[model samples]
Target: MAMNGETKTKAKSNLSKRGSKALTPFSPYIDAVNQAKSCQWSPSNEEGFFLMATAESVLSFDLVHEKIRTCREVPATVGLYGNFRGGDRLRSAIAKMMERTFMGVEVNSAHICISSGVTAVLDLFFFATCDPGDGCLIPAPYFPAFDNDMSIRNEVQPIPVQPADTHTYIPTAEEMEKAVVEAAKRGVKPRVLLITNPGNPLGTLYPEATLKELLLWAVNRGLHVLSDEIYANSKFGSSPDEFISMEKVAQNAVLENLLSAELVAEFVHTAYGMSKDFGMNGFRVGSLHTRSKDLLNFWQNMGMFAAVSNDTQHALAVMLEDENFVDSYVSENKRRLKKSYELLTTNFKTANLHFMSACAAMFCWLDLRSVLAESTFKAESELWKEILEECHIVLTPGEACHYGEPGFFRVCYASMPPNQLQVACDRLTAFIEKKRRKRKAANIS
Candidate 1:
């Protein structure tokens, strides 16, 4: 076959280091979907619910229409090139919302910088703060996309910090120190400690004490704390404890003299977005919140690289400004999330399956260790294949997230409706029972 012009150009081209970064287009779920595209058990790619899609959580379709209805209310001003720190009004709206969540923590619109997505924000943040070959400390079994966004092009390695208790996966200061030491031994300099508050996949929130401990460790080691609170508004457990913002932690640390106000201001940064909280993935609107003038100005100067459209910024800002609609949406979203969590957990109990107790984010860390035929990543891969190919459902196996160990998977529950959850549960239960029956028959044979 004759190579096309574009293909020929690629074959002879020499690119810059950043441009020459290997394209990692591999996604197991995408591969599986493509393989079954012609004849699928679940026709829509939406059934791949492990993707943390929360479309059903809020009434965005109607809300968007409402935004259009009030379109005339916005002033007739040109927004051809949006403000670098996002629209002035949008930044103010975001700051107000955050202040509500992290009360008494000073946050101003001027200190906030907007980007197209949290991923873009992270890419810029890492590029600004870390040189090539530097590393960031991340807890194990994290959101895997960070590897592609943080490292592939930017060369900022994410060194996984294993929990002191492997079984529980609870992060600690000791684990952070050990991870830092381990990275140093490998000749990688650990520069940032990134915490996914109301963590992804794990769906758990860090305790105030644990946050303080980690913050102190970061401050002492001179590591920047990148608090990823993308799911800050989505926390929905009935427990007495609630999702605590690291902003609050920073303020408390300053008050307690654990760190000076200047250090706390300089050391802490946050990434927030509408994707998780409002189920607005298509909006491409996310912001970086920090008091560091240097970083803020750096992002502001380069903000146009991934500037969100002025139209979208205005629409979302209007939606956010409506306190009544906002309250209703939050309450309804929490109700749906809690219902889904309970529904999934109750089924887990019925099946005698185990999972980590969680209160936030869109998924749960399911323990499928007992079902594995062997304790290996290979076993995990086989089990995952069987589940996806046969059951027409999706759950992210731990190995995909670069987890140290295997036999765990993340099932995103908030994406689908109760009926869909029922079907997935039925399929999962049947699969487990079939495995059990095979074990019994083999023993008898």
Candidate 2:
């Protein structure tokens, strides 16, 4: 409790200067991960703690395993070094997948670069585009790992674009421009604009108009736009707003003459992987789509350090090549995600807890501000610790995601079975009710 996510404390150490500097003072995300490793709840272990803090999905592992079993035979080319960028078949498969899912944008395999994961893809991109101390404009309440991913080794500074309205937490073009101006005042050179489509934690898609506005702002600023579409295919529920890729937006802008073709070609880029959408985090496979030749060459040469294994690439390519399997797998995964979401939200409604209505991604942005003792991040962290210790469940605290305000938590439903998630919800409701009763009792006294 003393080492909350908001506070930073450093101790004297013999570690390298960079390593010591990278030591995060508080990380509810990493703490939850370690906790889950030791005492995670499952069907076999009913008494164990429920880990609803992570963003992984285990609902469709059976489906993935069954399909992957058929692709076990590796090619002879896999024995020796093939393409360091990525295997030809895998890149081609990814291109097609992007074309189909990213709203009919024609993706060429030649423009794609593969790495071990989206984290690595981003690291490589930032390392190439930014000098040390260059700032990247990212909307706050974002994926917390982005801080370490872009900053730790790349030495890039992540400048948070605080939203005018924290309730939605979606930044407007005006807000982004203001953030860039603020960064300039602080002597931070802004280089890139990062977007997490079907946004992390929020689990909502950017309205098409908002997406266009943000992209055009980046174009005007001559900043590279890196769209993280890791959750592109995991969308579900009844949101009428469709998921639009950054590539399509930029292409349309160029066609409309709102943005120059050369600018779009050089600046618009996207990152994707099998981790979130396909529930294939263990695969360690991710790809970047870019039209910039310089970026492609940089990553192509540097990718050797982070290249995915040929065997992994071959298996994923096989999975992607099968239309029926990929389609069925995606549909089934969505159905399961929807069911899990409903299971969690149904309990929330019963407890009268407020949460952002999410239509994509695996998170439910739950509001516990009413239950907090005060309206501060400290209170939020205290509530998070209370829930973990008392209910034996792990929920990502708002401060962990660098949310603008307090008492909001990112509850992941897809990490465990629906039945297990139901147990987690039950424990959370009981905790909420207990707090409500205590407040009422104190008021009466």
Candidate 3:
């Protein structure tokens, strides 16, 4: 096929920005290793010194027993290498579960394409839906990995929607709409809007009404919605009825009254995983749900290039089929999360620090302006570095999450044990006090 003169000109313009330079490869594992080396080690040489980003829950005897039983029950045929690409039976089972529990009204076995994990699903979705240099809209204070994955690895341009407030980490729908329009005007029109529901760092769960509005807006703009609902079941202080899936919202007449089914169908892609909800990070199982036949066909073609491991798919299928197990697991985790949030909130309140509202998820977004105001550290990243150096405490700086302000940090409540959480709170309070005293002494001098 011959390219038109206009198309050739646009290609040349894009190529000019590249300047014939090769892209740099990103290795997160290498980064993690270097970070670990820079940090102090305890005299005891204990592993507890470094807190993990997301740690799996300690499995109870019952859960362990169930897993053992499931392993035994898994057939020899299921273990065969041919089943390594995921079997139809396992896919069908997962699809059925999605249809029944997830409000996936029209899902079938064929609609399901198993992936190694949420990251794999995202990579596949990007491969299927976007070309290199295509635009993807990601809200600020996002999962940092996504920026690395989409922008760095996939060669996609990430148009950031900055958070309204550094503390809140909530980007308003209006702001998002404006960003999309602006991106389109810049000739980098977004093909996908990535939303991390029960948001990362901020931990705010979007109300059904808010999600509906966003969906409608995306449909109007001809943008695809990639809903990252991995934290869907981690909601604190919310009932199951309060949680709304994109599929459910799209199907609701009163909720999506303005948008027709055809419009709604085009805009939605849901990504859910067992890692966040079940605390099974090692499982690496996740699903991508979409109603668009065209999108599904594209994904199917992409799957031909790469597929998920069959063993993991079978494990996920078994887990999904056992609703009772998932319910019990979610219930216990929710209780733990609620309690952790309460403890953290109490500590922050005692220190005269405030956190933005966090209804669900593992993190609490904190405003560090009061602490920053009295410190020599001019930026949040510097403050974070100082904290690590002086207090030996580690928290994600908001700047790293794409919030430009130098007055916010994210504390992960889920990864810390109860005692560790208490110690962390004490260290934070002490750090604030120490900084205050230094400022006061300097003022006196």
Candidate 4:
């Protein structure tokens, strides 16, 4: 075959074969969804699937029918819309909700920017705060989406802060500081610090003092703070007063003493939404708050790239403005979450399985080293796959959540019914027992 110079170059390029990171391991929950199609596990087809990896509200969509009826009775033109294509009314409503409930410190609506949801807000943050190749400091065992969002789309480096103890699963402030210091030494100079409140995969909330110290350190380092406060409302046994927003801390006089003296107009952006707290994942409404005009303008420009849907904005506006609705929704969500926690705790205790504290959020981080320690599986990811094949139950491997540590998995309690939770736990116990027996037989031989 005749080939031109260009063709030869292309052929050589193809043969060069640059490497890319491996595709994310298949979601076990997705595998469970596929298996549910073949097995008759529950009375109704609707109830059998347990794929709840997203922070979706279990009850958020059920109220939509009622909302539809309510909206019909009101005037069609009653909806709020500002003159601009992407106005600040929706942003104002979200700020009001946060001010009244969690933060209690008032913020101007003009200072907030509305986005599709928390993910959109995060995307905007990366675009605004980070240049390509800039690093973002993220505590390990974070929400996997953050790592994916920063690394894949934004092309920013993730400086991981390793946990002090994999067994206890707590993120230490010293470790976080060390990671940032090391990154700075390596010339990455992390521009932003991302922290998930009420923690995601680990399920450990930071103490007030620890949070304040970290905020001060970031301020001294001239780093912008990105606080993902979507899980703010899920804290158990704490008054709203106990919940402190980093934005609020930056404005506090007492904490300012420990921070930089430059009066640097410390940049702090808070991301809030209804998906996790209100169980309204479909609403797709979330807002980002910041005091920096530069950051605000950056987001405002990015808003042109992707904006929240009109109907979702209206629905979220109604929910945010109504004190009664917010109160009722929050109380009901807490009740449901408490029930889920109780069911999972009881099952874990009874099965003699070890799990981290479920202080808040819908998941329990389980240490599976006991099971993996005896198995022939050389990799924890492979062990996760084996568990799914044997037990027909799904779990998120710890690595997916950015904890490189082996022998840990995240169990979401919010998706499963109490009975199903018990059944899954039982199945897990049986699987572990079988593995133990096989190991014993091998030892005897």
Candidate 5:
């Protein structure tokens, strides 16, 4: 092993100045994603099943071919870097979809910017609005992926707007302002307020009144408002307080002069994506809309870092332009999700696992407090570990979603087939029974 006279080894080199930030370890969300990938289903791994850990739309569709119907002129896009503010045709279609299908008002295509995904758009959006060390006010029971997306590279932190109580984890407008003030006290400048309409972990829709109140709270503080409307067309609920579009609300405020046009232009920005709504996760296309001209021009110049691939743009352009086809596809997707949700809820109820019935997205935010060994997050982690190890199924721990409570988990109802979802429910019920039996044994002793 001596290298004195035989061979000399080269010395190690130093990493760059930003290496600490760049080469830093992956966040917990990345850990979950990796675990899901490793335990994903295949013939060999079929005995060990994958319960949904990540939120994705159901894949039992026969209409994927409908998305990319043509290659006649798609190759023409491959040679160029394309527009930084996104291509006109695709932007126009997105605008139209918002106007006709989801939002009530027409969107200006010039204000839309297309990127590889919502995370990329958020990165650019935050960079445009926030400085290093600044934060965005995010309500708890929020999406976990946002923790790193906000700051992992940009140094912008996600300041959680925690609820007063754990059971009903809804933050009021006052809570939003209080969170901003709290962040300011801690020297973290709150630059924006981010809300997931048809919320990710909660799976509930925000009412218009609640939306307006939060808008006033942010406007009073002069903070930008980022409404993630990625689940716009996923609504299948019968409730009167259904999905409400932020852009539509903004447009109305402008028309009625309740809020000044200048303020609307300066403060409001909306994000939407294809991955969830259209079930085109692989396409990696997302859109952001704003009324600010300065921000639009800034993206036009520098957005090449994560611009959508031209072929994807072309393929989506064709699909989104077909109003009738888009309408039918959206309707069918909702119908299927509603059916799956019903089955999941039925099983959960039969097992006495109380869960919040949702209006949108693929998850059921489960309340597992009754079965917890102790009313603490540590005990919740132990329960989750047991299920993941013994049941051979993955479930998202509420702690990962920044939940204020200790005993909650998000179980996706749309990621797998209906029959498989039934199996997942059976396995969960068995876990609950096992825990109950253990508790009874301890009591007897």
Candidate 6:
């Protein structure tokens, strides 16, 4: 389906200037993703593609679906126009769930705004807080789609703060400072610092001490802090008390006089959703919890475009209101996550592949440096292609995640059954062994 020269010219002319720059007509990563979708691995399909690239957990989806099914029927008002900021029933349920589950403090429903998804929540957040060309400082080895989330419409620039040691993933205070200076040089004003708790792809949770320090640092620099806690309830392989919400950290910081209450109210915000924690990505439900009256005012004027459907809101509200079901569901979800993570890591160890041990998110940062032909990003891209095209296993390349180095990839284990995971491991290990043998023969020659 190659386009002729004239056809290509016609297609290019059809697109708007901004649309042409933002859209991709051809991408190897996207091609692999489409292939994975068409041949997804299942029990009957032994030759199917292994989709380990996306951050989706199908482990406890049955529980979530059942809860949604049994929840109260959608209201008649759903047929009519609903509140732009979200219904009181759903927002109140979310506020209470925050207290009962993770936040450890009461949240005011009035301060919460419901949106179609976290993607939209962040889009509106940036629109309200920053002007065009303003930058948000995000750490390297972070979520790749954030480029789309921050930029596609809002025109907010993402300035990556890379760590001194690429393996650490988290950038140091000095590194962040340097990023701000560099952003200024590029004429991008640094307006926000985004922290992904239970780090995406890395799956490492920030310690309470480190969280406090980062919050204080942001406040001192007059940067708004947006903590995306979408995976808050997904922390496994640890005590429940080990997982702390950003709101709790902000409150404690204020109590300790490290941050002013006014500053914390205006600057600190949280984004949460049903996608990761509840295995309800299809629900398309996300919320923004902020104490800023300015943000709420902005939403009042422009929130209708991103509001969640009334029926979907009601169903999720009922699900959250059932405290017993919510409690048991969370416990079982974590157990399944822990089991899947252990299985994946055991296979990695058996294959002599190095990985950073993860406790929260569904992904593991896998190192394939030993199998690379050279220490370059180009080599990394080639390895990714080989694994996908030859081994039939789809993994996200480190380059896509903006990681500072090569030979690393994100492996999502919770997206498949254990049996399929074992098959994937066998294929991957076999590929690695063949590469090693060829390297040995080449060295001897």
Candidate 1 per-residue lDDT over residues 1-445, each given as its tens digit: 1111011125433777566554333235444433433332343654442322222243233454565467535555535776877889989988887776543476798878999989889988898889999999998878877787788767899898777676556699998898888888999998999998888778887778888999998988899999999888787885445678887888888888889989877889988988877888778889988989899888878887888888788877877887777777767677778888899999998998999888877788888898898999889988887786556655677876768888998888766567767777877888888898898898799
Best-to-worst lDDT order: 2, 6, 5, 1, 4, 3
Pairs that collide, model 5: none
Q: Deviation in angstroms for 425 in model 5?
A: 1.3
Error of 2 at 438 (Å): 0.5
Q: Which ten residues in a row have the lowest lDDT in candidate 6?
A: 1-10
Count clashing pairs, candidate 4: 1
Question: Per-model C-alpha lDDT, please?
Answer: 0.77, 0.87, 0.67, 0.67, 0.79, 0.85
lDDT of 3 by residue, 52-152 (tens): 33333432324634663574455666655543224676677667765665444667666566666788788888766788878888888777667656755
lDDT of 6 by residue, 81-164 (tens): 777888899999998887788888779999889998898999999898889899999987888788778887788998877778
The digit string of per-residue lDDT tens for model 2 on 1-445 reads 2222243447776789888877763364575556555867777876678777778999999999999999878878788987889988999999988887654699999989999999899999999999999999988788878888988898999988878986667789999888888888999999999999989988999878888999998989889999998998888878868899988998999999999988998999999999988889988999999999999889778999899999999988988989888888889999999999998899999899999999999999999999999999878878887887788788888887877889889988999888788888888899999999999999999
Q: What's the TM for model 1?
A: 0.90
**Best of the two (4, 5) by lDDT:** 5
- lDDT for model 4: 0.67
After superposing candidate 1 on the true structure, give the runs of residues whose Cα lies further than 4 Å from its correct spot: 1-22, 33-78, 102-104
Q: How many residue pairs clash in model 1?
A: 0
Residue 110 of model 1: what lDDT?
Answer: 87
- After superposition on all CA atoms, how large is the RMSD of candidate 1? 4.4
Q: Could you estimate the TM-score for every candidate?
A: 0.90, 0.96, 0.82, 0.84, 0.92, 0.95
After superposing candidate 4, which stretches have Cα over 4 Å from the reference? 1-41, 44-49, 59-65, 72-86, 165-173, 184-187, 237-241, 253-256, 259-265, 374-378
By TM-score, the candidates rank as 2, 6, 5, 1, 4, 3
* Candidate with maximal TM-score: 2
Clashes by residue pair, model 3 = none
Better of 1 and 5 by TM-score: 5
TM-score of 4: 0.84
Cα-lDDT of candidate 6:
0.85
Candidate that beats the other on lDDT, 1 or 5, i.e. the better one? 5
